[model samples]
Target: MLIETLKNRLVLACLILIGLYAVVSIGGTLFFQYEPNSQDLLQANTGPGAVHWLGTDYLGRDLLARIVYGIRISLTIAFFATLINITVGFLVGSVSGLLGGLADRLLIGMVDIFWCIPPFLIVVMLTVVLEPGIKNIFIALGLVLWIPTARMIRGEVRVIRNSPFIKFARLNGAGSFQIMARHILPNCIPVLLTTAAFSIPDAIMAEAFLSIVGLGVQAPNASLGVLISDGLQSFRVYPWQWFFPVLTLTMLVLCFNILGDALHEAYSSKAKGLLEHD
Candidate 1:
């Protein structure tokens, strides 16, 4: 299954791009000459050059370094938020599907209530209520963005729970926990992966939006959104400040989007093949 998915050219390309971003973000300091926050007023607003690979921002901070560091911060926040989303969504969905009737209805109702509110709005409100910082943003995003994942997981769990194999397991005196842990959860891996792939870009974009509006990562700390916001101030004179970050963000999001689509297609085709064989 993994081999088949990797055979896709689009998926391979996306993976490579994402890998490059991760590597650069992780080891950027080794290659870059300047720290993200280190300022040199003499070099401020300069275009791309040998000294500043992607040029310097209004404060003369290295654009390339800031971008790489910003990518690290953005990816970090998105990764953690997605982690929380998966954990909470999986637990709620598994319990809801495994124990039906009142529990199912109540859980579904709660999900629906959250679903009705725009996720970004909920995140914004949460951020406002909490103090503005990276940790708060992570908490805000995680709390609000799990609705879609939970819904998808719930539906998948319900279907798996109704399968003949699950019924047979039950008849064999398997406990609910055993059925869920040993049987149902394994079958839901594809769904979880697909949902998680999609959820990452959403989390990245959400962090960016919050930073742009001044409700996210504060000054001196760079995020893609923070970079873009900073660039906007000097856009007319020095476009590199705005352009590089925007381009980076676009590529980052595009990579995730394509990867998610590819995973969805790969998983769907696999499932279809299995059904036809059966």
Candidate 2:
């Protein structure tokens, strides 16, 4: 029965894709001897061959090596930044939803300030004022991305904050923290997981966007965005440079999206079944 479901198929495919990416990101660094940055002018602009699975760039570096490193960087940023986003969003949303009234309005107003501000302007300012690096990119993205997350969680929590489960917890002498952490937060897990899964792709793309603009991972480092930017310069002569990185990035986003959808569907189905049984 599970195998026949579309959601199950998506979940299976998503897991396989995520597992393959995880191996490449982790194992590639230790096992792959190819130096992403060491360039040989003589071997520059070579097409994909037995020696180089992808090809050589204009600077004669291995495309496969660069891609491996790039994937690691994107995945790393996405993972950590999403963690930060979810953590902050969960706390803020929980408080706002559980404690209604003026406090909720004030917190929501603060979130609005963050949401209202222009993210691109902030990125540009950060890049110019400070040095362009991976850490800075992570910080910038984390700051901006959490706004939407907080709002989403706030909305979700509001819907269930007044439910019988919450009332029972409160009536049982549970303190505010106990009620929120034990009852409310646990109930919000499915929404949180789905939101987090979908946010991964956005975080990765944000890092890539910053890298493209010279504000993310420096020149010597290879990120998917950096590779794509480098490839654009020599696009007329070498198309492989752009194609491989873009393809990898696209697949990553697609897989995460699929996983998010699959998770949401599965959770919804399970919840429905439980309710029906009750």
Candidate 3:
């Protein structure tokens, strides 16, 4: 009943839209060649028209094509970064939470140290040291983003570790690893799942920030961030340059956040019901 109540139709619709956008972006890149960087002096800066729907860029590059390609790269980076964050966070969090004393203290201290360092500042520092590119952006963001997730997971782990089921498993001669894998880990699902769902938008937004700072998604790549940054130079005369890319980014982020929140509420409600039953 709680799950049913939390099943938001609006969120479901947004998730479907996000999925569809991903398919179009990926499929278009694999099958077509619209030339994201090919310039045409004759067609430069033309407003929305039949030949050029979204219009051409400052260099007369196809806006639609660039937007499509940009979406693919942005989404890919976000997905991979989120994956790394989840894997590292879950492992670190679970281990720390399941084991108290020295191990927990060390992990907690590390997390606190990382928390003191701002993520954007870390990314900027890394960009200065490391070569700025798509891959580097992912590595930098993943390294910093995992800290928060690890903390969240660790907190969840502490709660789950004390649950009755985990206690029973431990009493039945289950080893620490076995208790974590079979009992504690299973209960930690709600936290892990929600953390992952929330991380997607954060990853996407982070990528945009990194790109805007001139340290990510290099020239001719056409990430929405790159597009917006380039367009901002001519915001007064050619507004479309900044308008469409920002619009696309806004929609994408909004959809992901809505869906993530919906999933979070659903799982939280489910967890609450389970606790009540106990």
Per-model lDDT: 0.88, 0.82, 0.81
For each candidate, give its TM-score against the true structure.
0.96, 0.89, 0.91
lDDT of 2 by residue, 3-73 (tens): 33344766777778888988987788476778778798888988999988899999899899899889988
Candidate 2: deviation at residue 250, Å? 0.7
* Candidate 2 TM-score, C-alpha based: 0.89
Please state the error at residue 274 of candidate 3 in Å: 2.7
| Cα misplacement distance, residue 265 of candidate 1 (Å) | 0.7
Sort the predicted structures by TM-score, highest score first. 1, 3, 2
Instruction: Report each candidate's C-alpha RMSD, comma-separated, in the order given.
Output: 1.3, 2.7, 2.2
Per-model clash counts, in order, read 0, 0, 0
Best by TM-score: 1
After superposing candidate 2, which stretches have Cα over 4 Å from the reference?
1-7, 126-130, 267-278
Query: Which residue pairs come into collision in candidate 2?
Result: none
lDDT of 1 by residue, 153-174 (tens): 8888887788899899999999
lDDT of 1 at 69: 97
